[model samples]
Target: MPILMLIEYFRATMQQWSFQKRNVAAEAKRTLTPWAETIIQANKNACNNWMVYPISNSRFVVKSFTHKSVVVDFQQRTCTCSRWQIDGLPCGHVIKVLTMSRYKDCSEFDFKAYFIETLRKNYEESVNPLPSPLESKIPGDLMIVKPPMMEMRQPGRPRNIDRILSQGERPIWQECSTCGKFRQTRSDCTSRGSRSGISQATVHIQR
Candidate 1:
């Protein structure tokens, strides 16, 4: 299903590219990807939810409605929330701080990864359609491989007793009736007790 989706995406991308006269980078810039535009819009909306307090020309503290505050350092390009550092895109706190500092464009601070040129380069490669199985050629020198043998199950309802025993309906170890111990039978436990008694008798004789 994932492979089919990828094939469909490649087909659609190639179909769209066929209509474009200009290069992929130019075409990509003309129309921004949905995800890039979405992030931009989200950051813009989030600016209203934040309150910016200027610490210096490059440092700021942005407080949200929930009383959550994060420090934004423009010079370092980092936010205490760590989103800006990880994603390479200015998060809500950074955006709010930048806006408070009278920075007109927030996109200048966005990472190169989100740039249209980067996106264009990623999709620039052509994916050719595969040849039909009928047209596919196999080397004559290669050995022919046969399908694996199928093992047929016995034609009866499987015994539930074995399944139950395997699943712990019956205990694997037998308890010794003589010593109340597991794994050994009553006769084996009696023999062990006799050996211990003999050892104790020998020690007493030596003493």
Candidate 2:
């Protein structure tokens, strides 16, 4: 009976894998058409000057006018909107800046700069490692008492860690707008906040 069950499980797993592969292939074929220009136009239509805020020491915040609920960080190069992170392209507000400035071919639009290598290299030469300058020697006359090790207690509550952030994960770096420093994400920026903020431009999309 056990042998029969094992054989049936194997057959079922193979069928599921085959079905999944076919579905993925079909989806790929459907999405292969050129759609960048269409998406650019759509973004232009919905573009608005969102409020930019410094979310943290290194992050900026932006709020949506139409939706009235989204926050964005220009430093982190992230928006509360789901589309930008998923697509690896600038969001509508970002595209608005590109179009307005007439800088479609600028460095800001280069998607590769957002990755680990180029960003790290931008600041690499500035960071130098040095050993501690102070030297200290243990005093021979000082007596130190060793405490007994207590029984190991089970950890209480687990720390709330962002699962997506792991030690093994490399940073996606971006160039700092203020200091010209390259950093791992915009959050590593060293520039102080500016009182002058970017204005929102109104864009109309064509049908």
Candidate 3:
């Protein structure tokens, strides 16, 4: 499914699950468990560090939350810890300090957006083409010896519809007479129930 469709499905599910309560405070009080709050606080704390400071207009200096020994550059927004690069989110050390200082509401800009922009810029810089002379030089020696390309195999065996039609498909479910629920059909059920003199209307599944 498309991302937009998936997002809509999630929104619909959330709306269905939301309780029909009038007061927002009442809803929060009912839903907010102590354990949930602790987890939220822990996640917030993970994104902070003392070394984490906005160094200049575009740069920030930080240290790794996972590895205290490894310092980092938040301006370039990178860390020795791969988590920063993999997820492109502010690491634990940055998050912890940001929560502590309450820098989220600051007038300059949102730190989250700044952090994302830093990673985006880094990705853009990596994809930018090199100068023409250097680009041609790197591929020249490698492309000289042409390796023989292997032939790719086609997909699986073709269907034999005639053979399939010869073997009839089995019925999966039988409708229950007593209740509407589906039950496995037994060949001897009619005889067995008649011998026992049980009311067919009240008959229950053997299983």
In terms of lDDT, model 3 sits at 0.45
Which one wins on TM-score?
A: 1
- Candidate 1 colliding pairs, count: 0
Off by over 4 Å in 3: 1-41, 47-66, 96-102, 105-207
Model 1 worst lDDT window (10 residues): 198-207
Candidate 2 off by > 4 Å: 1-34, 48-60, 97-207
Locate the minimum summed-lDDT window of 10 residues in model 2: 198-207
lDDT by residue (72-170, candidate 2, tens digit) is: 455667667756677666677556545554655423542554433443344333222333324546579998889988988778964433335555554
Top of the candidates by lDDT:
1
Per-residue error at 36 for model 1, in Å? Answer: 1.4
Model 3 poorest ten-residue lDDT run: 198-207
- For candidate 3, the C-alpha RMSD (Å) to the true structure equals 23.7
Candidate 2 structure lDDT: 0.51
Error of 1 at 72 (Å): 1.5
Candidates in order have lDDT scores of 0.68, 0.51, 0.45
| Model 3 agreement with the true structure over 1-207: per-residue lDDT tens digits | 387567666766655444222122233442233333354456566554445656555445555545554444546666566555654454555454455456652212223433323333333322222244435555455657688899887799743423322244533355555444444234324434533443223223222
For lDDT, candidate 2 versus 3, the one ahead is: 2
Higher-scoring candidate on lDDT, 1 or 3: 1
